[model samples]
Target chain A: MVPVDYYIILSAVLFTIGALGVLIRRNPLIIFMSIELMLNAANLAFVAFSRMYDSFNGQIFVFFVIAVAAAEVAVGLALIVEIFKTKKNINIDEMNSLKG
Target chain B: MTQTDFYTILPLTVLAVWACLLLLADLFIPKDRKGITAFLSALGLAVTLGLTITQVGRENLGFNNMVVVDGFSTFINIILLASSLFGVALAYGYIKRMGLERGEYYTLMLFSVTGMMLMAQAADLIIVFLALELLSIPLYVLAAFARPNLQSEEAGVKYFLLGAFSTGFVVYGTALIYGATGTTSLGGIFFAASNGTPGLLLTIGAALLLVGFGFKVAAVPFHMWTPDVYQGSPTAVTAFMSSGAKIAGFAALLRVFASAFPSISVDITAVIWVLAALTMIVGNITAISQTNIKRMLAYSSIAHAGYILMAFVPYGNKEVMPVSVAAGLFYLVSYAVTNFGAWAVVISLEKAEGKGLEISDFAGLAKKYPALAIAMTVFMLSFIGFPPTLGLVGKFYLFRAVIAGGYTGLALIGVVTSLVSAYYYLRVVINMYMREGDPTIEREQWLDFTTVTTAVATVALSFVPQWLFFMASTAALRLF
Candidate 1:
């Protein structure tokens, strides 16, 4: 069996990449995907830790996180559709109408 | 869940059910009769408030200790319900006037309040995460409630994106904490920390949690989304988010830190002290330049978060935790009442399609509506922490608690920034009385009533604050 440290490191790396994608991406679609990646990374870490600790709590938490991520994706896509309908673009940079 | 668990969460359960019922009832009701939903929502909140009041001072752990019923949660719940009532009242006029009236507006607000109430009662990290989402998802929708409007849509997307990012931080942090401590319960974490020095993973996790909460409360460095979201959302939604979501955020913050991380406070307190100072300086200084009233208040709200964070800076001190926490709670109540009142006045003066919201639009308000002008002046006075208003007493307690906790330097920063805040808060007063313009009002009876009552209460309550102060202190005592 694989060691838990390897899984945790992979999860942390994935989380960092996802966070960077969110920071660097201009498209709302990609940003949403990045957020999903981040959530899944947390899910991965939870699963890894659960196995190491022989505890079901972390696994249960992962299930809840997955469920929440699905809901978040649904809402995020709906908002993106709403924005695209009016502005005809999904770029965050172009969606700056409410400024100081 | 047992019968005891159901009873422990009676108010939250009632509110959630009522909100869903309102959503279904809206489908059958005609478009012209949306006011019924608002009235029904307010009635539900009033009943839930009563239920919550009955449970006050009765501490219980239910749902296997995932939920807590105690003085702290009850006090915060009362503030949440009262703020929602004002939110609905203010929304009634603003939504109708702007032709944005929808039953979902009230329903979503009720749902959001339920989330907030749940946050106050959350005893586990998982519950905190769930409650955060429950509170926020509705707000993201409410921010974009004025759909087809480009600004509103933009606000919704921005808030959603950044808000989701913050949630990621919270989740990852929770995972790390669980990794370090092997438990997600607050009590479990406390036991783990008290046993030995927490590992690097736990400290990093705690920092990430602070970042997540800092974003929620609009503290500086994470406040980039606040002004835009507040300015673009419907004024009523903005009002609710500013007061309700903020109080919930602080409730979760205070509870988690006080209970779960007392042993780790030395490290986190330094980070919090800097956050408090930076938020106060940036929030106040930036608010001075905003012409948009919504944006100005957004910054003011951020500055107020800094003041509340001042109380948390001394959380490590065993002797001062209760006083500091109580001061933070009292300040939240004072800010909620005065903020809702200020926003009510703004809602009354707001025109269709979000016009007439500029600070200059308030010119000559005194000449047009003497009563409104006086109310706005009182709100402004409260925001500036002037004497004879609740804001002054709240700030006095906050500063005193900070000083008692031996964070006198942070307290000095609070005082100076508050003094700096006076220039902007009073600027609204100056615009209302000293300048001249044809300012008009929407003439909504509900909104006017909210404004007048909150204003009067803001002043009247200051004279007899002992009861509220005692209640808040007792609430904080339970946590300690």
Candidate 2:
């Protein structure tokens, strides 16, 4: 049987990588993918903890998270497509029309 | 699952159901007559507002206590519904004038507001997460609703990316909390914490949750996206976003921290102090150099978030928690009113293609329209927490609460930042009154009405603030 600590450590590492990808990636699509990675990492932790505790609460939470993530993806892709139409390029950093 | 469950969340259910029906109803509405949609949305808000008002003094736990209908949620719901009503009023003329009128805009607004109502009622972390997204997704769509505008489009994408990233933190935090306690319900977590659920996981989970909410409320260190997003969105949306979104974000903060983590307040209070202080100092100082009015207001909203955050520093002190929480709610009322009033003036001055947004654009306003200039001045004063405005009374209550909690240093930072904030806020006033330039302005009935009404309320309520204070105290969170 796999131990829970190993799963946690793995999830944490994946979360960190996802966070780094979001901060470093210039492409909007890549950033979205990174965000998905983070969500999946959380899902893994939730499932592992749910199993260890023998509770269905954590698994139910994972379902909601998955649904919310799907909704986010739909809206996010639409936004990216809209931006691409106007600017003709999809570099996130190039969005400097409104600056501090 | 029971009828009690439906009764407890009657207001939220009503709004959500109305939004869905309105979404279908909007499909049939003619494109040229989007005003009907706005009116229908406002009617929905009015009905929700009435239902929320009826829920006052009636408390119950529903969905097996996954949701709460209590004094705190009731009060915040009243505020949210009223603000969305104001949001509808402001958006009515502004959208038509901006040539961005569409039934979907109002439908989306109603949907966003439903999410906010849900946020105030959320008792479980799962509901909180879902509510946050519900409120945010519509806004992500609304922010870019100024269709095909490059700046608005960019704003939408930027807001979505940052918003989603922050959401990841929230989900991860919830997972950690669930791992630490084996439950997702806030009440269950409270029981677990009190019974001594010992681990680093819970504390880290709380910290991660703060990071997520901090982004929502636009606290500094996580506030990088605020100015750009606020600047690029439509003025009416910016108006709604600043007040409505902030109220809902703070509601989530109070709900989670006060309920689930009082056992861990010792660790959380210090973190809140630093966040409050940094949010105040950074938000105020950066706002001073802003040339664009929209960007300036964005930073100003950030600074106000700091002031509201100060009331939470001593949340663990039994002697201080009630007063501080009440003060926080009072301050939210003041900020929302002033925010709407200020944005009303901004929308009035804003021209197509985002022209007339600079501070210099305010010059000659006194020359052309004295009443508008006066209303604008009142808003600026309120933002600076000056006398004869509700902002002043709100700050006084906040300072008293923090001092009573024994956090005088945070109070001092709040005072000094308010003083520093005067520099930029006063600049707009000076331009409106003293400088000389003729900036063409749009005259809309709803625009002028909202501006004048909120400005009057901002000043009048200061003199009679005890009523607001009483309401806020009555709305204070009940102890477990």
| Best DockQ among the predictions, by candidate number | 2
The global C-alpha lDDT for each of the candidates, from Candidate 1 onward, is 0.93, 0.93
- TM-score, every prediction: 0.99, 0.99
Candidate 2 residue-wise lDDT, B34-111, digit = tens: 899998999999999999999889888898888989889999999998888889989999999989998889888888
Q: Which stretches of candidate 1 lie over 4 Å from their true place?
A: none
State how far residue A24 of model 2 sits from its true place (Å): 0.9
Give the DockQ of candidate 2.
0.91
Local lDDT at A73 for model 1: 82
Model 2 chain B: which ten-residue window has the lowest total lDDT?
A: B471-480
| Interface RMSD, per-candidate values to 1 decimal | 0.6, 0.6
Query: What is the lDDT, from 0 to 100, of the residue B328 in candidate 1?
Result: 96
Query: Model 2 clash pairs?
Result: none
lDDT of 1 by residue, B206-234 (tens): 99899899999999999999999999998
Fnat for each model: 0.76, 0.88
Chain A only: give the TM-score of model 1: 0.97
Give, for candidate 2 chain A, the lowest lDDT window spanning 10 residues: A91-100
